[model samples]
Target: MSDQPANLREQALEEAALWFASLQDEQVSEQERQAWQKWLAESVWHREAWAKVEQIDREFHQLPTQRSFQALQSAGRSRRQFLYGLAGAAVALPFAWHQRDILQAAWTPGTLHQTAVGERRQLALADGSQLWLNTNTLITVDERAARRQLFLLHGELYLQSAPETQALRINTDYGSVDMMNTELNIRLGNNSAHLAVTTGEARVQLAQDTTPVTVAKKESLAFNQTRSVLTEGISANDEAWRKGYLVAENMRLEDFLKALGRYHSQGWLKCSDAVANLRLIGHYPIADTRKVLDTLAQSLPVKVRHITPWFTLIEDNRNISHS
Candidate 1:
């Protein structure tokens, strides 16, 4: 409903983002919020921007906190010196370029930051830690005065803990991971969690047992409600996904499709039994599932049957008997 020109809308949106971020910060003062109202009353565009930013939050699931946005703005969104009228220009942001409209979630307390299917997001927390959220992930972060805590509710994440707080703790339903200047990957399944520590060490405590378990560098552990298995070999594939690729190292074809299905934009993706055990070896980009499916058909004796955007079935190309 905002008829403001694109440029004004963009500027309004930027300021709205700053206000949204500012309001959610526990450090925000009443005076600053009152100042936001003054700026809001200055123009219709400002109100529209605020509304738009709120709408974005409704869709995206979480807004970037100060720590989250500060680093992200430094990464992909080009920055320029911008002074805020809110807080009487007390805040400064390196906001000079147009940012993607979708990252507008305002980080509020206890909110879950999520990524849609087929989408990956990298977040830079205020504590200097970095987090890359895999597709269809849900996680919550709590950075209070004394320490920082992360909750991995579902899906996968690759995190490099900030040196400032090696004591940061991450909680999943299965247990908690206490980082010691760590770089790690975690994925939560229906009844289990898989953790891989690439560098540094972590102390894990499962829900069923208060006993702490140590996972050293290069070690991978998968645990459920009752048991845990410490193994190896995740060093390669897990790291590859952080770089936007799904690497299949002689992985089974059905398993490969299972991994790819996590990033499928819609519907179900499956392979027929005939090609279920076919071994696949390749590193395919995950940004486009359709492209990956097409590539899969080209590389092996498989036929990709894309009935619609929502239905995909891969069958044996060599079998000419069935439809």
Candidate 2:
């Protein structure tokens, strides 16, 4: 009986190994893709075993290309070398590695993600990373094992990366940054790109044309993705969304409304162009943005009107209050 179980285990591992090899070829026939999909869905054990192999393969790929080659080339090195490293130690570590490889090979380069209006999604990567995306956010994941990569096309997100054998990176319209055990928030504003780190640390290598800056815990920074203005440790104001709130410390009314609008459905919040330059300060509940609008109406000269359950417009062509 034990011998039968042992044979099954060996069979499973062999199947997994083959899948890993198949993933390397850039071109796979549709028939082969369908066949693999069938095998993955046929039995839970088959899927689970293949999943393990994939995780291992991803970690293998993530290794700095040189380091990975060295480890693979070294007779002394074992699979364990790639199993124990990551931002989060997945006891199912091999599973994480294998999944990474699987997803990378399957992804077509330059795939873009977009949210139409009141859409938000939480993405979980094969390597165990979690992305809390805000409405109207656009992003793409580039799954290279040696370095985990994400490209933010627009809007905001909260990222918690899984442990890996190598560094993890996030790319923006401006430049790219590597993250480790950290929480990062990104917002693309007019003429400026903003970043805030709530926990841990990040190394931001500015665009080659601009100056580089590193952001640490509880710090905020901004730069012109198109220009060379680099500022650091400005304030920790961007962490509000993580708690379902928007804490604006002396922010322009237009900017505040834009940030607040992400929490609600599309067309729900809008500010008149006249108040675009008006600066306001306070903590607004993102979870209940309507209440915040009410507060704004009472405190400021503006009036908030609900166009629908899904939309609201704020207008104050003339100033009724001064700050």
Candidate 3:
């Protein structure tokens, strides 16, 4: 919205990136460091771009080096190359930080159990209950004399409680769900939490509501800190991700891609406006997202464009067909 041209802004970022790269070298001269400082002080845009680059570097430094290097390696890139690309392309630092935070939390030793991206794990509790963790999930189990509690830091998990005198509770930022002898799935979304009761019953106590809402068997509820609970029917295939497949029934292309992206470690999936609203119905394997995209392109009026190993775009095939 400002008067700055896109190309100019990109150029400024690139210039700032060069200075950063230069400073990283052990043989950098005093004159070069002075030049970089002078350039950084010359213009506001240059300073702003350098600040963002520094922020990205700071976040990366906070993460475990091996994990960060592995993520870059999977994308066929190095850390320096990725940082330069981020600067030139103006990648969102906050989003990168968020992903790092998820990975960091998953690696935290405090949690009794955790799962990495595209990895599902099963555990047998001491009380004969079972727990299944979905991709990028972090949960800590607390078994006290009175109750069994789980704190879901991120992602989704399916729980089957054993028959016990004490109740089971799952806690998140938005609220908590209390259950006993119940089979349920809990997913932590960006702004809300989803609780689906596959068997038995559970009660959700949202932070905003004074009274708790009871979720019956075969019912799904989504609630946030500010909104009332929205309930819907749960199909048998709702928990199919536990079996390594995502069952989509007339789901929007954008929504489907977002769900699929969670299992993919390479990069993000983006749908162009021309195809974002298109509906899809199918069971896609969570194991191989590239294959799923290829299959989707064959079935739907869309085309998959791989911009990079880390970025894919889905566009309407009608335009390509006409062209």
Candidate 4:
């Protein structure tokens, strides 16, 4: 009775692992499919654990060799096998042999890296690529000679991918995108992924579908989890967030706040409905969201209120008499 929570957590993680494995199996049933989807959207902890499993799945799919891929596929835990590893070793030996030793050698524990109430971090990858982890970001990378991949599990990342021997790809929960000599960035919301290409050309292919659409430089695309339709837009400052600032020229207040919230750990930035239509044209820093918020409040006809450590509300302040 005392260990039920721990058991449930472990069970939840195992269920996530099974979900990914089932994706690679052709005979997966509709019930199993719906079950996995339900678990994913069940709770924050469930989603986090599922993300860790997907992180590993992306790594497995991006490996340079088939042996590594097979190993990962075999190491996948089953509800029965996880609980009876010792007893099932004999029964699972043949499958394990086919899986290879990649899983054992490259087992990476899951970790959640997040920004504090107001913090940001610049990350440098081993391949010389750079990542600007947005506030409250939880990302994981699986780099290999044959493939370069990133899982923008939540939040956002300003990615400046370095040249690679092979193609580079960024896999999200919804789909996978491929890049070529380009600077691409991704922002993950509830069930959507917004992608912007700052420089060079690239292509994005939805996972459920095969054909990919080419995106020229300075193009942006948005993808919803359940829909294959991609919404397209244009932004000159596609990579501006990487420069520690977001440049907006006559952007709407609501849109600007949405972008600003990406760099905030508190993840709450709301513009009053009264001032939502206000036009904003300025540069907001990504490194320090507080500075940006302060600058906006002082420069605009609004009052910034800290509702909580991580939540902020911007409202109209029209009480200044003609004194």
Best-fitting candidate, measured by lDDT? Answer: 3
Which candidate, 1 or 4, would have the higher TM-score against the true structure?
1
lDDT of 2 by residue, 54-133 (tens): 66556655655544433322211122232222112322443454444335434634445655333557788667878777
Question: What is the overall TM-score of model 2 with all chains considered together?
Answer: 0.52
Model 4 segments more than 4 A misplaced? 1-118, 225-233, 307-311, 319-323
Writing each residue's lDDT as its tens digit, candidate 1 over 104-219 gives: 32343345688766788999988788999987677778786366788776578999987856488888778888896899999887568999999988888888886788888999
**Model 1 lDDT, residue 40, Cα:** 91
Report how far residue 122 has shifted in candidate 4, in Å.
3.3
Error of 2 at 7 (Å): 76
What's the CA error at residue 17 for candidate 2, in Å?
A: 64
Write candidate 3's Cα lDDT for 153-206 as tens digits: 777899998886478788787888999889999888767888899989999898
Predict model 1's lDDT versus the native. Answer: 0.68
* Pairs with steric clashes in candidate 1: 63-105, 63-106, 63-107, 67-126
The candidates, ranked best first by lDDT, are: 3, 1, 4, 2
- Provide the overall lDDT of each model, using Cα atoms, as 2-decimal numbers: 0.68, 0.59, 0.72, 0.60
Cα shift from native, residue 68, model 2 (Å): 51
Give the top-scoring candidate (TM-score).
3
Assess candidate 4 and give its lDDT. 0.60
TM-score versus the correct structure, for each prediction: 0.64, 0.52, 0.68, 0.56
Runs with alpha carbons beyond 4 Å of true place in candidate 3: 1-110, 235-237, 317-323
**Given candidate 3, what's the lDDT at residue 22?**
47
